[model samples]
Each structure stands twice: as C-alpha cells, then as structure tokens.
Target: MINGISYYPEGRKYTYFLKSEEYKQILDRLEINYENIRLYFSHSISFESKNILEIYLRKCVLDDTLDLFNFFEPILQECFEPETNQYKFEQIVDLVIIEKASNI
Candidate 1:
C-alpha cells in the first residue's frame, strides 16, 4: 500500500497502456493522489537482456490512477542488483488502474 493507501494497478494487462503517454499524463488519467503518491528510485530491475529488466511491486493497491514513479521507485532503490550488460535502455509500457468513486 502506497502511503498507507491501498493502491495498485488494476490489472497487469492495463499496465501496457500506462506507458503510452508522458509520466504526468498517466498520473492525470489515474487521478491518483499525487500528494500521497510518493516517488522513490529504489525499485529494482533485472537485466534479462542488454535492454531488459524485470520489475515488481510488493503491495501497491489498484486505484483509478497509478504513478509509474511509484512502481519504478522501489526498483530504483532496492531491487535489481546483478547486471552484466553495460549498455541498456528501458522502454516502460503504460499501466492503468480502474477505481470506482465512493458514494457521497
């Protein structure tokens, strides 16, 4: 849970859609509480290939909006370690989270 909020990308398939636009655009679409969504660079990525790294999110909840920064933060800090390739680029795919508004 991000910032004590149960938020995660709704489905793995939708994640492919989140990377289509700029980071801001994705956040806007998700309507995630940016104020609450913290950014971290401790995330991890495994170098499966010269330009590929596997990513993981521990317990993020699925909400209407999702921040790549959130998913990427942990990887940037404490996950991926071993890498042999010196040249590699990551192309992040888009991710979407479907959330329903609470009744007032």
Candidate 2:
C-alpha cells in the first residue's frame, strides 16, 4: 500500500487496459532508453486519481545503458526510503512500485 491506499497490482486480474492519457506523460519518466523496462499498466487506480507506474525488468537496453537494476536502483531505493519524491509527486502518479515475478 502507498499513502494508505492499496490498489492490488499483485492480483493482476483486476488491472485493465488504461486508455486515458492523463498519466502517460509521467510514464516516460519511469521508462528510460537506457533501462531494461517495458513500461505498461500492470495495475493502476487511475479512476481514483492514483497511479502506479509498473515496470518489468528485461535484459536488453538501448544506447549506453545501465542494465535494468543498476539504473532503477536509485529510484527504487528512493521510493523504499521515507523521503518524499518531489518529482513523482508532481506527476499524476503517487508512487512507482517494483515487483519481480516469474509467472504472470
């Protein structure tokens, strides 16, 4: 749960295709050209004005990339910490959560 709200992204079944563009702008902030992430709406409570930018890890990265974990480690670490992310807060998304899964 983030900010006292839990929109179960782990359940997966409840997440649907998000056609709204309100949150798209912030999405680019999550997926960078150098990271091993294929950004998608794994789960989001956009209807309630809460969005979680879910990114999956992969191998390949374009340009002079910092692998998957290396690049996002700082960002993820910041999220895990108690400090508030001013940049994320400014966007439509309240938090960016990461989960490692073998079975989808």
Candidate 3:
C-alpha cells in the first residue's frame, strides 16, 4: 500500500478534492472532454468559513494517487481561500470528513 493506506480499498480511486480555479485550469488543459462533468458543492462554516469541490472523475487520466496529489498540490497551494481563517477551515474539513465517512 502507498502512504500507509490502500487507496483502492478506500473507494477513493476516482475521487478528487480541488480548488475551483485549479480545477478549471486542469479542465482547460484537457479541453476536449467537457461533456463529462459533475460538481458537488461543500458549504462549511466554523471559526472560519470555506468552500470545497469534490469532483468525481468519469475516467482515469492520472497514473496514480501520488500524481493526483502532485497535480492538485500546486493548485491548492497557490489558491486555497476560506471565507475565514485556518481554524474555521479545519472545522469545515472535519465536517466534510465525518459526512463522507458516514456515507460509507
């Protein structure tokens, strides 16, 4: 397993978390494929407020999870803005984590 976990077993093989602008950039890079699109909006509030995009890919384009992370890292680092601060962002993330886990 990679990163002390089995990504396949976790059912996260096709799931991705990305910033909206970064997501747009990637989409532009692959301009031909626009017919397949799904967007799940995450609205969160805590000491800080934030937003997130959970994108369910229709196909496997990236080679591996590491590649996915690397692809998203630059985008995330360059533009991760919350309506509030870090603490609130964490709270929202926690809520998302819990909701996602419960759904499984």
Candidate 4:
C-alpha cells in the first residue's frame, strides 16, 4: 500500500516551443486555424519559444504523481504510421522551468 505523497507537486512556470519538420511545415496552417494543434490544452502554445508552456498545465497537473523522470507530456500533432501500424512520435521541443535551477 502507498503511504503518502513522495515528491513536490507544485508546477512551476515554463516556456514551450514546437519543433520537428512537420511542425514547421504546418506553422502557417496553425496560425490560420489555431485549434489544429492544441485546442484546449493550451491556447498560448505556439512557435514562440519564449512563451510560458507550463502555464496551462499548472492548473491541472501537479508533480505529486511524478517520479525522477516523470513529467507532464505535452500534446503534439498525431501522425498515423501504416508501416509500423502505430502512431508516430518524436521530440517536439524542449521545455525550461522558470523557477528551477536547471531543467531535468
């Protein structure tokens, strides 16, 4: 059985950026249709790397359930892969916590 909380759950301010060739290709499209990538997850998510990415998640996701490597997973464009019969995944961007001494 579990005893109690283990780690800090408070979410800190952060900045987000979208990467990948796919993301770059659709940048113009995203501007025209803002909801194409992240509709409700975060209205502020965009090409601007300096924007606060964790702002929206702060309200909903605390670090309570997190472990050494566990962290909030941001949403990205879903790409279907027929070859592997699975969805394609890749590193979209890097995130930096505003208050943290350094990002993990």
Task: List TM-scores for all candidates, in order.
Answer: 0.22, 0.21, 0.21, 0.22
Measured by TM-score, how close is model 4 to the native structure?
A: 0.22
Return the top candidate by lDDT.
1
RMSD of 3: 15.8
Give the lowest summed-lDDT range of ten residues in model 2.
42-51
Report the C-alpha lDDT of model 4 over 1-104, residue by residue, as the tens digit.
Answer: 11012223234324333443455456444443222332222132432322243443344344334332234322322222345443332322323222322323
What Cα-based lDDT does every candidate model obtain?
Answer: 0.38, 0.33, 0.33, 0.33
TM-score quality measure for candidate 2: 0.21
Clashes of 1: 27
lDDT of 4 at 33: 22
Alpha carbon lDDT of residue 100, candidate 1? 57
Task: For candidate 3, write residues 5-89 as lDDT tens digits.
Answer: 1223343445564644565566556553333234434433232222222221112233344444344444334334455532211
Q: Candidate 3: misplaced stretches above 4 Å?
A: 1-60, 65-67, 84-104
| Predicted candidate 2 versus true structure: per-residue lDDT over 1-104, tens digit per residue | 22211222332343354433434444445442222233433222221222233232221122233344454445444444234332131123334333443333
lDDT of 4: 0.33
